[model samples]
Target: MVSRKEVAERAGVSVATVSYVLNGKPGVSEQTRQKVHAVMSELGYKPSYAARALKIKKTNHFAVLVHYLGDPFEAGILSHIEHQARRHGYFVSFQTYHPEDEERFLQEVSGRIDGVILLGQSLMPETLNGLRSAGIPVLSIMEPMQQSEWITTVDMDWEAGMTQLIRHLAEQGHRRIGFMATGIPRHPHEQRRQAFRSAMLAEGLPCEEEDVLSGGGRLEEAKSAMKHYLASEAARTCTAWIAANDLMAVGMLSACREAGLKVPGDLSIAGSENILMSEQTEPRITVLDYPRKHIAHIAVDMLVAIIENKQPRGCKMESRLLIRGSSMHE
Candidate 1:
């Protein structure tokens, strides 16, 4: 039964001062803010989020569902998303997406968050339908498999970027270039593979069946896969290689070293996403840089718009290809 008036008296401040502190508004000094917080904690006065939701029908919280939080690319996207959400007066909760936990996730997030921001295809179509029926809007950072009224997607222009990369390699006199991918069926860059294929065909080069290798999407996986591939005669088909990510590209670099092949001298390698570690490597990695911050900002804005009843449109961005020390004519 403790009121703001009682906390104000205990903190030796006015009720308006208490309100400012509670709302985290300006005009409260650090000393006063701390004293007010101490008084409120002593009085066991907790603001009820549920009660506030009942009044406004908004929890001011957003849920970000991702395949894994440890991935550097996903982490970068998350940091910007959280920053944008915080600027808009919202808090974020990150949930790791698992097929077995879909139903439970739906149950857990229902009425607890204002909306969902999907870093990838985290939920099944049926689960997405459940979210739609629950009136929750979704903003997916990656391209969606299918479009829905409830889901808005913001993605980079994969075909354009891949075409540019392929053309760059071709211009560097590499006609027989191979592509390495993560191989997970639903991982975000399936489009990248498709784009690479199309770009190869457009350039009159065959993306032969044997030239496609699966690195399983991580640095170690790529290194292991490449080491095995380098053991075989099939590695002779391509003079250059394109990896789906910078980490995978780094893995290729390590594998090349293990095989005693000089990069660009023996085998040229290029990467798709330019993560920070790409620059930290020896000779560095060449990659396509998509505007991660811009995409995150747009996704959060779209979700907030949907949550507030403003219809938002989907967006497509372009990626800039950075040619570095790894790729060159064989």
Candidate 2:
């Protein structure tokens, strides 16, 4: 009901000043910007997004496609992305990926949003090409399953993180270390697996095929896999285990309890991503902090750059190791 004119008049500023402040344009001092914002809030003036989109040719909305919306790690990252996007005057729409509907989903979101943010979902080449042709920038929060120049990624250095975890375990006198890998194929998972093997070899430890258990990246799946591993000959020889993520590590902890194994005393455990639940579990899980806020900031900033026709670049962030109860040996 209230218009920019009313807000400008009440604030004793020009309508153009109100427009500049609302549109996030330059040339307004901090003092004037604050005053205009206060007047607009008091007057309950709402900008017309449709008119702004028509003038700027931008929807100012971004679509985030997540692999699993229920997963704590993904959900945490989404929260950060939403917060960062809001600071830039943009809104985020979240959608879970369905393999069968990839094409239709891409078609629907191609031009409706200014850009797309992918959270560990691998898009088909055809769909990616379609988005690229449509001039929609795509930024992935993790390494893509397949490499494409069109997709700018803001990813963590999984190999480095895995290597650090392995080295830490080795330093703690854990030579017979095992890895819990995800059953599903993903770029980061594969990188962690390879890094585990490489780090073991570098430390002069054995990394046999049997030492790598497929946890399937879920709590139940990881529990099942760890239970099976606990009954195997390889489990008897292994002294430490590293999971691909914190959820899987929690499952490993549950399996350890069920099997009457004491964490760090019977078998040391570590995980990646440092999800919130990691700390609540008994003998809280040690994990690599994935820097969720930093990744979100980079992804949103890169997407904005791409939308502005600027040269956007991909970056690899490093994870910090959080030493916790589970990984400390007695």
Candidate 3:
């Protein structure tokens, strides 16, 4: 096997310099970093995980498992997690797995890192048990499940976020509001839907069962779903639409354009998670400004605390509603 010493000699740098470069430390200059990388490639050098695990007595690494990879909101959370992990002298690895393959991935994860950050709604009890037996602490970034004592959790107050959004719209005279969502309704952290329901009910606003569309994760899926919903009988009565996320709201806007509908003139749209893309669209989308950065920071801090054996208190963040051209009439 090509060793670090050999690479260090080939690069004409000290062994310590080679170590710093390979481990992604910041002290090495870009030029030196490039030279060290070249030496590693030429020598076919690969770091031995088992040897390092035994010598350093730590992996100095963590993993983040996400179920939904395409969602921008989820991506935002992940970016923040990675930043926090790097700051704590640990590298973050991301893995996407289906429910059927979760057990296998958990097995692989056990051998790879000291801890895990889950951006999932819930994990099967069996999977939780497997992780626990492996001595891998999990920090879940959504709603807390039955194993609150066994796992660390941090989540956005989605219910309050959406409640405030509805109240804002109601104050603006949006009486005939419509709610739309696309995707399976089984996610354990689906507080946005519940909040929308409660808000509409509290205002004595009518919520038609048909107005709540399902299966809306992808752009095309939401576009098709919204188009079909518009053709349905409910569209004749409802004038405003509240999407559970910004991506779906963008799709709704596209569907409206296809049907020759003008936003905020013929219909109004609102969504959750005020991502950057939301502002780029024409007549920017009104959405619940979820604290994506704050969410990532808190979740990571909790994970680090657990890894370091430090007791972390219950941490929480707030979500706000951002009014924009898509959902307001001025």
Residues 229-296 of candidate 1 have per-residue lDDT tens digits of 99997786788899887789999999998899988778888888889998777768778999999999
Q: Give the TM-score of candidate 1.
A: 0.81
The number of clashing residue pairs in each candidate reads 0, 0, 5
C-alpha RMSD by candidate, in order: 15.2, 14.2, 15.1
- Model 3: lDDT equals 0.74
Query: lDDT of each model, Cα atoms only?
Result: 0.80, 0.80, 0.74
- List candidate 1 segments past 4 Å from native: 1-56, 147-149
Sorted on lDDT, best first, the list reads 1, 2, 3
lDDT by residue (1-330, candidate 3, tens digit) is 688899899999999998776544568877887787667656756454444335344677888878688778888889888998889888999986566876687768765787888786566655654554445677877652434455667867766777788788777777878777654655633566777888788778887787677745666788888899778775757778888778888888999989989998888888888878888888899988877888898888787776665656555567877899987753
The TM-scores, one per candidate, come to 0.81, 0.80, 0.77
Error of 3 at 305 (Å): 0.6
For candidate 1, list the clashing residue pairs, or say none. none
